[model samples]
Target: MIKNKLIILSLIGLSFISCNLKNGKIENIRKGELNPTVELIKVEEKKFILDSNTAPQPQYTQLYQDSSYKRKFTFLNTYTNSIYIYDYETAEYIREISYDKEGPNGIQRPMGYLIKNLDSIYIFDQLTNSLILSNDDGKVKNKISLIGDKDPKNTEWSLSYPQYYPLTVAPLIETTQELLFTGMYAWAIPDSLLEKFHFTSRIDLSSSKVSFGHGYPATLYGSEFNWDDPIYTAVYSDLHPDGNKLIYSFPVSHDLYLANLDSSLYKTFYGGSNFAGTISSLEEKKSSPSHAEMGVHIAGTDLYGGIKYDKYRKVYYRFLRNAMSDVSKDSNWKEKPLSVIIMDKDFNYLGETNIGTLKNYNWENSFVSKEGLNIEYLHENDINEVYLSLHIFVPEEI
Candidate 1:
């Protein structure tokens, strides 16, 4: 089984060619010979050395904020084995809580978040197929299991592709005390399974429970058609500043969907084209697909998204993009271009600006501050070389 997984990873790496720019020149942009000035700001990097042997691989990190704009806490997921909490200001590991007392072994990628006002954290464990509750101190308090009687006709019943199994949990958000979560399931499963087990979006905490709506049915071919399922990939949701609406990213279709607290009305923003990229077909290999292409192909790419509201400009900062393309051969990749984009609250077109474009440039993570400041991590080719870039956009004198 491990060997098979390794092969899959290798194939994914070889699937596409690098998309880096050539001769260090970005497409559609002019090359300047002037001495370019780039600012370097330093952020304190405190280490939280964990028991590497015992710690599950860290898969994701989320920063939480209080209503007053103070840093609350940062949550880390160890791929379903355990959830760790760290102090944002001190950078110290606070606690580690495992969903299953026995700990995570395989197929469990637990993802979660810290709800505001609540002294507890909510986690979604994909391996054990359960929802876990933990106190602020990282102690396990309760859990909700997702696994039930399986039907042979159910797409989830077939263990052929466990990755598609509705086991990977998305981050958890809070609406008061009620917690909300989104899960993905393959479409090939039986209709009965879809009705009973396939859940695209839901809100459940202690007493309150609500469902956004049923997901589209899965296809039987178990091939490309199955990719059409709305819940095939990672689904992300964040609470609006108003606290009444939730913004979700439907990765499969590469569309951003907004759902009200009532889950009564849902709409797509930016006409769906605002978040997608163009892909061109490259020459085919003797055995590879002819239509195969490379170089930052955005169509059907995975995306990371977030929103920040600004009262001064009466606009919202919506950040969206997919993983950076491996541009090893292209000069553009060497001098990575900043693809960060900002959009209005209503999805109106504002303008495009490069966050940072310099030699040995690589972006790791980004977040918008309540004061409308954008903070991003720029890393060198080396894993340890990282810098925090603060981008403050002050409007011109009126």
Candidate 2:
């Protein structure tokens, strides 16, 4: 279940003059006043049947592809606490990097695994409250704990959020020097911890400094920040592959915000549809920590599927999952269709498509990989069998 949540967060932004729908250029009427010409690109899809011969069903699947694995579809299973490898063409189960849980170097209840490279991974170990660096062979190299209080560099930039480690990162912006992280918490911030609520922070690993003042004002989008849920949902950010620009969005509104890691640039393209009126009160948004509602994309089902930056094809994507208009709640949305809103390199509104409904909302069911956008049809291709049906999306230049 925990892995399921992380999968939803990672999985998904662009630009815009008057949207045209004629001659492959779709006409779009945005909720905002910006009437700009926009290009519409069609998507092509194919599926690489994932080899399910090795396991019954995975609890969670994360993209773990590298050159060593032939650049094929590889996944890390949270259920098994291991990596599963498959052939790109054949969908055959080649190997699994299964790890132990009882050893001195082992971890219990790992929050998630970051595929830093083919070899090493930073496992957020719940038991130790540390990120255990381990090799593909399950060898523990090191474990780095959060240097919150003991960092001698700056005492003011301390991480004071309770139980901090959701830490959503921009996929394309990860570098040796820095990484962008989302600060989503439900705690009430004191005056001392105001700097900690930068919304998006640039953690420079080389200098050991947490760069502040690089985030949009939470009060503007989060409906008055520092109220109850300090770790609000509106602060979720994704990387723009064009220049690795920081991208953010409002959950219930049609507002899309673009900025930089240093907070130097700021731009917004408010492109929304007729159903964009889906909104909630600031008081209602301040739900309990456990029940905090997230980005539904003006729909009822999706609870903030974080923005995704596709590096393979220089474009941005926002997955509007299971959108159902007939109801106000998410119960009926599970049977509705999914839409991938397309945007250009400059964050311009491009086009969108209804990718159909889904049965398995698990992370294993879908991902944007080196082989284009891949979504598995669980009902058609069963994991209980040898193969799973895949739905792939590629760019069809129109």
Best by TM-score: 2
**Model 1 bad stretches (over 4 Å):** 1-58, 65-70, 77-109, 115-119, 136-138, 147-170, 185-199, 208-233, 251-255, 261-265, 271-314, 320-338, 356-366, 371-378, 381-398
Q: How many backbone clashes does candidate 2 have?
A: 25
- The digit string of per-residue lDDT tens for model 2 on 142-179 reads 75554353442443334542233443222313554664
Model 1: clashing residue pairs? 19-295, 20-327, 21-331, 21-332, 21-333, 80-110, 108-127, 126-167, 155-189, 187-218
After superposing candidate 2, which stretches have Cα over 4 Å from the reference? 1-29, 32-69, 126-129, 147-159, 162-173, 179-183, 186-195, 199-216, 219-236, 242-244, 264-266, 271-275, 282-304, 326-330, 358-367, 380-389
TM-score, cand. 1 vs. native: 0.56
Q: Candidate 1 residues 77-170, lDDT tens each? A: 4543555556656556666655443543222455544455345666555545555566545466766544433332455543322222221113
Report lDDT per candidate. 0.41, 0.49
| 279: Cα error in model 1, Å | 6.2
Give TM per candidate: 0.56, 0.67
Deviation in angstroms for 264 in model 2? Answer: 7.4
